[model samples]
Target: MPTTVLVAGFRGSMGQKATAMIKRDPELELAAVYSPHLETTDPAAYDLPATTQVFNQLSAMDTPAQVWVDFSTPAGAFENAQFALEHGMTPIIGTSGLSDDQVAQLTKLAKEQHQAGLLVPNFGLSAVLLMQFAKQAAQYFPDAEIIEMHHADKKDSPSGTAVNTAKMIAAGRKQAPETVENPVETIPGARGANYEDVPIHAVRLPGYVAHEQVLFGGPGEALTIRQDSFDRESFMHGLNIAIKQVNRLKGFAVGLENVL
Candidate 1:
């Protein structure tokens, strides 16, 4: 039997794409879809056969779904994940903007239940590789900064991927030397936000899909690693892999790198 999966936020862009991918794959089956805004007739009203049942509320769904995939808003994602975990269902979370405290709480819950939950801030393989490269270069430079660019409509600044990268780099280093002694500031907030002693600059523009650059400076040498996601398809491959592997994991796991 195919693995049964329930996708929340089924009407959104990424959610729809994931649904199509699941439908096309032979090893997965879409057991249900939950979206507050979408009704049961919405998909069929457009002359599309409903491959999965739609529910306005997650609690209303009675099907025994094995895996729950979240591609919804930050708050919605958390709520859906909590419900899934309480019900003994594995959750693959792709939502961004989750805070450190929230992540810790989820991790604790997963441990208590002995269930697995995955939180992936960025699903693009290039972004994962960028983080891996940054982690490797942290020891040599010890000083670094991040610049993240995303579409203007994005709700969160200092993308989660950038924050996670900074945390990873910080974890690998013993100490980060202060970059400036007497920092001069022409403006009040000219310098970007600092994550774990690393500076992070966020750029929100109309044209950018998602892009990030990690720069390392030490003595006379500098190194830079960059990644870009030009289209939504960049995330599908990683998301598919996470969905398949999350069931085998216990407790909370962050990043696609672990699964890879």
Candidate 2:
């Protein structure tokens, strides 16, 4: 039987691509599409089948969608995933604005409800492998930094992949020695954002799709691990993997590698 799916943020670039991928897959059914920003709830307007349900308001959503594939904004993702969990739909979250606390709360709720889902940082297999490789590298080189580049229109700074990479590095590395910030620089924030002692630099440019590099330095030597997603299609393979394996999970979890 085909898996019924609902796509949030259907009007956005990534969301539109996900919708098309679903349509092309015979095993997946496009049961619905949603976007709070959309003016019309007409499925036809969204280039969906006439039978596909459309929802502009989360409060009004009533569909047969068994899987909630969210490519919504960071602002809307938390609530969207929460709704999916509450409604007994397995959520495959791709949007990345959720805080650690929010993820914890969702994790708790999922276990209580006995629902299964995932909060994926980056769906590109290369990105997932980069994060995994960075974690392994962190064991040997404790001093590390990350630089992430995305398109100019990307709203989130320090893309989820960068943040996840930092977290992975933090998890694998030994205790980092405390150090004071350099006061010599005239610029106040030139050092970039700090997460668990790992510095992350985010670059926004017109030509970049999504790219990240984790650099580690020690004993006058350095190692760099990088991944690039030149096109949105790069993420489809991992998302497809998540969608297929989510039903086997016990509760809400984080990371695409977990599903892989």
TM-score, every prediction: 0.94, 0.97
- The candidate that achieves the highest TM-score relative to the unseen native structure: 2
What are the per-residue Cα lDDT tens digits for candidate 2 across 46-77?
A: 77999899998989989999999999988889
What local distance difference test score does each model get? 0.85, 0.89
Error in Å for residue 254 of model 2: 0.5
Worst 10 residues of 1 by lDDT: 40-49
lDDT, candidate 1, 70-102, per-residue tens: 988987888888888999788888878888888
Model 1 pairs whose backbones collide: none
